[model samples]
Target: MAPFLKEFFPDVYKKQSEIKDSSNQYCKFNSATLTMFTSSLYLAALLASCVASYITKAWGRKISMLTGGITFCVGALLNGAALSVWMLIVGVDL
Candidate 1:
């Protein structure tokens, strides 16, 4: 998924640059920023999985699955509505 997102970075950056003010840092992210974004997601997912395992053990598979589904839906909505690069990152992190 991270690799897929990276593949679209150029298009995403172009559109974001067009929509945002020229001075906005969000519109100026370079390849290093992309690497950081992907790395952050990888780290967050790793930590979340560790915590989710405990929640699943305590709550059972059904509850865990439902919680995950709801969380994913909320994240998708956030990502879809994001107006800035930071918001998009937050949404993806969610």
Candidate 2:
């Protein structure tokens, strides 16, 4: 969590120093950026699941799987290369 916050969210990373005197790490890092960082992945997964059946039916199984795999790979790569918070939200994959 600290390293993640440090990379894309330096502003929030500054707040981590407050944890040095206590064990309430969870409470210390519940910033809005953290919420979006974690929740975006779940939201993306939900939307993908909702559309997956339709995509699978519209295309053949092989095409559907290939498309899904390509999309997942691209999303993962984008997430891995992200340098900003908004980029993370846009490309977050599970």
Q: List TM-scores for all candidates, in order.
A: 0.64, 0.76
* lDDT assessment of candidate 2: 0.79
The sequence of per-residue lDDT tens digits that candidate 1 reaches over residues 30-64 is 56657766776887698779878998999998998
For model 1, the superposed segments whose C-alpha errors exceed 4 Å read 1-30
**Which stretches of model 2 miss by more than 4 angstroms?**
20-26
Specify the highest-lDDT model's number.
2
- Superposed Cα deviation of residue 80, candidate 1 (Å): 0.7
